[model samples]
Target: MPSTDFQESSSSPSSFNLSILSRRRDQVHSMDSPPLESNGQQSDLEAFQRTVAERFQDLAAAPSEELLSIPWIRKLLDTFLCVHEEFRLIVFNHKSSLAKPPMDKYITDFFERSVKALDVCNAIRDGIEQIRHWQKQLEIVLCALDNQRSIGEGQFRRAKKALIDLTIAMLDERDSNTTVSHRNRSFGRQSNSRAEPRSMANFRSLSWSVSRTWSAARQLQAISSNLAPPRGNEISATNGLNVGVFTMSYVLLFVMWALVAAIPCQDRGLPTHLFTRQFAWAAPIGSLYERIMEESKRRDRRNTCGLMREIYEIEKCVRLMNELTDCVEFPLTEERERQVKQRVQEIGKIYEAIKEGLDPLERLVREVFRRIVRSRTEGLDSIARANLQD
Candidate 1:
């Protein structure tokens, strides 16, 4: 079987490479023939984490320190940290899931998927290091010009060359990972591999909840289709409208449920709900049925007008994102900075509008959960009261 573990290499980059270097160093240190000290490897990881945190703080505290004040740079660092943390968690969980040493081919393929995730992190780290190094070189150039010294033409050229090289390497890494991901998807389809979870929570309880919630949501949609209004029916138009509203509300609730199921994948903090007193709850089907009844009584109600309106709003927001993507391209020119800022603001506006629609959906789901808990509490109290009377 292909090695399920990350391969240990003889050489490791000192400062520029964070993700791969750390992993490589850890592997080498742990697998020394004589098995020296393990604490050293742990300390290395700790120091690397501290360095990354310090660098982030420095940039955040004084953005003026960097030669270029680009918003995307900060975004890049933030995204890198998020992905690195997630990949780390996945690796930790994967190791814990193993029964013993000598992982099977299936597990090895899973590890390869994780390595691709780490490859992206490594590229991000390399790009950040290049930017910081260039910033330092730019400062040196400024000082040389001020003091009337030789402009250090040789060093400046080298820095520029290094930056270009790093950019190319990063792009190549991304492209390679994309190709691997496509190949894996094709292989998975051929092999009939397990489907990817809707939520990427590493824990079994949370993962199971996510899978169940997603499955239920999809099943609800399928079932609701059969409940659709009959064509050329003898039924009154108002009754048809009521049925349509009823179906629409169920569809909305299921969609909301699916999004809730996905929260653990997007935000790892949500997994605590699985272990804590909190339970996964969604908007009650009964409440939606009641809303359908009320909405059907309204005169202006026709087909799924409200649902269609929400869909239109969602599409408009999607168009805004597409425009932003089109406006922002690679090979960062001077004009790209202004475009990045403008498009970022446009994205923020679109995010807020989408949040407006989603917030109510999430709130309704939570309210349903609260009602379930409350009713359970009340039932327990009534049983206690009856026991006392007895």
Candidate 2:
């Protein structure tokens, strides 16, 4: 009877627990279920707040000397800060040089945009809580740079045409101001000079030179046209390859000369209204052009450093995790192992996401830089030809 009672007790224990489980199964199910949306978000927010607070405290507690003792982090900070400082100087100096109304307006606009970009850099350099804001700012700055390039090109072209027109008008005025008697005397002198064989020789030499040049040009054209035609796909693929660079650099060269023309004329006691009008027209465009170039370069550098910054942060996280590993009790437990694995996986995913986001932005900047280089190459070629002719 005692053996029977022991067997029944052992068997009844399992059934009793099973009944309890069945009775409270709904309670267990509810506990296992995901929290309500609001509760989940609130919990997440609280966790994030706690994490951010802890991060801030940790960052504050870390000695600058110790942080800087880490070679890579020091180098990263130095390079980032130095580049941004240079960018700041460039923008400020450019803004200070601005003079006329339109120029002031454009400079202000560009300066504002540049400041926004710089703000992003500063935030990243300072190790802010949120990175997404700066990422968007970087994109905004890129768009602004592109827009500045386009508008600057347009303004420069207009100013160039206007300057050309003004120069022609001035020449016409100079000609009209000359007396008919002076013209007659000049014509008479020219008629008398025409009797000389030197003039005829000179004229013949000029004609021969012209004919030679024409023949050479024709031969070059024929050679080009006779070559196998490029496929439509090939041509289309390469068509806009250097558009941004060519557009900017083309007007850039012309803008330099226009600025030169405006400067001395206004300084040499020419009518203020005459030259200042054009100077005012062009000054804004020049500032915009410089701003575009500076900002584009800044954007490129920032985009490159962005990935490095993420890596730095990830390293910090990893270092902290490594430090805590020894402190964790029961490090061989399945739960602990799972948590570590999950964390490592999360860090890896974060790294991958950062890399993926930056790759496209870097590619875009690289393409722009390539276009600029191509434009520079063409400019050099043209300069070489001009020098040869001279």
Name the candidate that leads on lDDT. Answer: 1
Clash count in backbone of candidate 2: 0
Q: How badly does each model clash, as a count of residue pairs?
A: 0, 0
User: Which parts of model 2 have CA positions greater than 4 angstroms off?
Assistant: 1-308, 328-331, 354-369, 384-390
Candidate 1 ranges with C-alpha deviation above 4 Å: 1-208, 211-214, 217-334, 351-363, 376-390
Q: Which 10-residue window of candidate 2 scores lowest in summed lDDT? A: 263-272
Clash pairs, candidate 1, are: none
Q: Return the top candidate by TM-score.
A: 1
The residue pairs in collision within model 2 are: none
- On residues 270-376, what C-alpha lDDT tens digit does candidate 2 reach at each position? 11111110111123233322322332234322212122334334434344444434344532466754554454454455445544544443333233334334433
Provide the lDDT at 235 for model 1.
16
120-148, model 1: which lDDT tens digit per residue?
A: 22222322332233234333323322232
Cα lDDT of candidate 1 equals: 0.30
TM-score of each: 0.24, 0.22
